[model samples]
Target: MIIKIFSLNLRMQGKKTYQEKLFACFSLSERVPKDNFYRQLGGVLDLEYLYGLTRAYYGTSGQESVDPVVFFKLCLVGYLENIISDRKLISHCSMRMDILYFIGYDIDDELPWHSTISRTRQLFPESLFEEVFTKVLALCISKGMVSGHTQAIDSAPVKANASMDSLELKVPKEDLESHLQKIRHISRMDKPHRQAKENKASKTQQTIDANKQELGAIKSRNKNWSKNQDQRPGAGNKGSKYTSNKTHYSPTDPDARISVKLRQSEKTQLYESAKCRHCPPCHHRYSSLPCR
Candidate 1:
């Protein structure tokens, strides 16, 4: 019998064979287009510089650490994707073939655990991240995306734990709960007398005296409530703690000072004062422009 070989034949054929394999030959990079965003970013970002910065964290002779370049690339992916959760970042990168190609991971390759990304972040200092930011900013400037000459500044005061209407005179530090309890007690005791005076049909000397006493109690209550307004009911969301420049110092910002703005009728407002520490060393104030 003579066997015939035809190399030019092209036809679809079905085979009754059970052939299942664990792996197949594939190229991730070739599957992704050259003009892809991650592809361009990979080419533009020079992550080799990170080696020197990360060298101290690794030892010369131990189990290898996750590649710093890959780690940072993943971080960039998170920012570009606007994914704040690390676990979601890993899952997102894993499912996308283009991202996998950009990160140089094979289809079947398992991604590094999400916890590794957090540990890597804590390992790197802020200064290193700042350095990377500066480089990226320079790149943007080179690309004409940003101009170094002009910058918008914010002159508005930062929101703090204290308020303008809550200013109090500095006094001896005392228990805030105790003060609140005492005020509440006074509130309860004076409630009946104030109500009775209001119910009186005619104004008399005794009623006038009661009215005077009620006014005094209300004045004192308003004064204390202004300083620790956060502690009072209807102040804010439930269980919110109160702090004042007089009784309590800001644990987060100890340098903050208290200032006051006096209004008509002797009403004063308390303000948590802080200066802009990040202002340029030499800047000219443009007072001519009206507030926007």
Candidate 2:
């Protein structure tokens, strides 16, 4: 039994989880003299010109000075390659030497706090992201690889930040109020929810089913609010959504839509084919799409 356990442990340990592979492979075998992520970036973008264009927001008089270029590069990569959130991005950088090298941070350096990353993002406008993208495209143009004849674009369904199980379509007056009250009560009591500790000792998944069930019931009571609203008194109710369909999607469900669409961005006559805006990459393009 001890050997069996030992064998099982080794087998489990052998199961490899992929760290994010840098797919925007700025590196290649027959590399040109100038070949680094930034070099590749320069080949695809005009970094200095865009940075010059970015309106710098001065930090508070006493706040510690942050390296904006570093912060911007971190954010740029975070978007170019979709990681779910700033936390995951920083976590990857904290562990991966390649990411550390790309970001110009030391391998041993402590990762920036997730909150710091989020706060820094709020300091700039969306134009920064657009400018950065365009700069890269400019480099792609310089490489004489910019294709204007044909374009390919597609869309996919992505899970939203909010859990569908946590959302209600109609949210009846009584039900919405009830949930608000329940959450308030929980907040007031500040009950300790040590699910992690309990699971370790008991070797069972500590249940949040009760809370989840309660939320689910509230959602059911909302009575396909979207459907009902459209039918009730008509003013193009097809678009009348209190929240998004994706918002109610749950990350836990294996059956949930896994969105991964790749397409070519079209070329346009306008010098600026991109616009600047700060947004979570997953939802950014879909912002123009209707709620449905």
Highest TM-score scorer: 1
The TM-score measured for candidate 2 stands at: 0.41
Taking all chains together, each candidate's TM-score versus the true structure is 0.51, 0.41
> Residue-wise lDDT of candidate 1 within 1-292, one digit each (tens)?
1222232232334457788788777887888899988888777767788788788877789667788888888988998898989999999999998888788788999889999888888989988889888877788778766644444443533334433322222221234454445443432432221222122122221122225555465446456655654443212223322323333222223344433233322212233433222223244374222222
**Regions more than 4 Å wrong, model 1:** 1-21, 148-223, 226-292
Candidate lDDT (C-alpha), each: 0.57, 0.46
lDDT of 2 by residue, 96-214 (tens): 55556656566445767888888877877888777666776777667766534333334434433322222212222345566545432321232321121111211111112235666
Best candidate (score: lDDT): 1
For residue 69, give model 2's deviation from the true position in Å. Answer: 2.3
Model 2 error, position 49 (Å): 4.0
Per-prediction count of colliding residue pairs?
2, 10
